[model samples]
Target: MAAALSLLLWAGAPAAAQRIVLPTGEYMDTTSLRNPGCGAPFYQYYQVKGKYPVASATLARQAQAFLQQRNGRYTGTGLITFRFGIDCEGKRLPWTKVLQTDAAYRPTHFAPALVEALYAYLQTLTDWRRASGPNREPANYLTLLSFRIQDGKVVAVTP
Candidate 1:
């Protein structure tokens, strides 16, 4: 859907850096994404700490509402997991990775339209809580969101 991709472009993902490698060996060109030159994304379950409560939990709630607002589109019983990073300056990078699986836990493809819609919504979140080093330096870390769908509806969102 060109329209969907066009909307994704406005989400600020530039075509130069934003790359989408579909299983069909095709990629979407997004030409204006803000390059979050913060740094490499690192994940350490034990190392990441919050001097404050992580606000990503709030984002999870918002995503649930988003699904409800567009109820008829996302159809299927499965799980969609997204892994991404929030840069040092609290900007989300474009290296988002999505994994989908059916209710039986087998790898599968959820509706592409649904995936794109949700991905677009994630790009709109501006309330990311930046993690900082003990000395108060901006830090880059990875985060995840898993949406559970059942009977063509998003039933749960997990962090």
Candidate 2:
């Protein structure tokens, strides 16, 4: 009788396993998962709370100010997109990538300057609240920044 009860209890116990749901709607054991060639975790931004280092309105205002200060000018309307990761300390990760630009103006040299200006402005954003995950641990945040410029002036900034 003791042996039978022990066997029953053991069989009824929950398994100590973890499963993660993939983006393709497939469930996979956490242990069976492998990192892709990207050298980064699969869910890099999953646990992040506040994605942007600064508030949207503040970013927009700063972008405008930066453009005005540098006398940045453009001939036609264009868009610039930037991507980067913010670590748990609210500092930008060493990985900054300039995705692409939709420049529709002459003097193509302005594009690179615009990118640099944006980069410089971003470097000033150090007062960020660290992102936390569901487990209450600090997590890295990935974010995209978009800038719209017309006639050499920044008209909008989106986070």
Candidate 3:
């Protein structure tokens, strides 16, 4: 997956920020490409490479704002990792999973709320520009979203 990440980062650089027109004729900013996570055999099998699906900056900012609003009401610190996939049809494949959670925060009452909120925010995202292989067939891509919260504030959100 290192190769894929490298290609994505390279194509996403400011100098290479060309607009990629999808099969559906939607224009996507190359810089919006995100790091498709590793450790998934599906990615290797499909030979998926380069940029992955990502929300527009405006939508991403809105989602972050929503998360921050929800985090403001919580009282503990923790990290949450969410995994999901985007299918060839440019639809979210209902394969969401919680990859990890801090033990202290796992059993908290607000834990479910946080998870649900993130899921909801993800659902609000538009369809991604599908990844294609050498054959030009669209392939599914795995993605990871991580949230780090501290003292009831969201400290970071990583790809």
Candidate 4:
């Protein structure tokens, strides 16, 4: 009876599996992903309290500031999304990809250099917080950030 009860409790425990759902369809060779030294089941930031690179508003501001200096005046009216996993050590997984789309969500391409520059800038960040498992163990977190562009200017960022 005790064993059965234990099993029941275990089954009732919180889920630790990853739950990533992205609208990404196009493939981008933007950043050469490196092997993450950490293992996962990956979880979205929302799955764990306080497990994100920075507050959403602040993240957008920072990205805007960075891109303002590197936009190169290349024009595009579309959205770019970056999707990947971040390890406990704040390292990105070796499968990061970018997807670009027009305002109507149709697949499109932005200036390759501009997209590549943004990808490189993302890699330079080191403040991502790793999500914790239900058992309080380290778990890689899935990250997705979308950038809104207009005539080569980054007008907004969403995470």
Local distance difference test, per candidate?
0.61, 0.51, 0.49, 0.62
Best model per lDDT: 4
Question: Which ranges in model 2 have alpha carbons more than 4 Å from their true place?
Answer: 1-47, 103-110
Worst window of 10 by summed lDDT in candidate 2: 8-17
* Model 4 spans > 4 angstroms off: 1-24, 28-37
Count of steric clashes across candidates, in order: 8, 2, 0, 0
Candidate 3: tens digits of C-alpha lDDT, residues 21-112: 23322111233343354222335323564233453344446666987766536544776555556656555544344543453655232345
**C-alpha TM-scores of all predictions:** 0.67, 0.60, 0.54, 0.70
In order of TM-score, best first, we have 4, 1, 2, 3
lDDT of 2 at 19: 23
- How much lDDT does candidate 1 score? 0.61
Candidate 2 matches the true fold with a TM-score of 0.60
- What would the per-residue lDDT of candidate 2 be over residues 1-159, giving only the tens digit for each residue? 334222211011112212222232211111222212222321244445555656677777788797679786645457655555555655545334444444653222234566667666766666655666666666656766767776666677775
Error of 2 at 146 (Å): 1.2
List where candidate 1 sits over 4 angstroms from the true fold: 1-11, 14-41, 50-61, 134-136
**Residue pairs in steric clash, candidate 2?**
73-152, 74-152
At residue 23, candidate 1 shows an lDDT of 61
Which model, 2 or 4, shows the larger lDDT? 4
- Which pairs clash (backbone N, Cα, C closer than 3 Å) in model 1? 12-33, 13-33, 14-30, 14-31, 14-32, 14-33, 15-30, 15-31
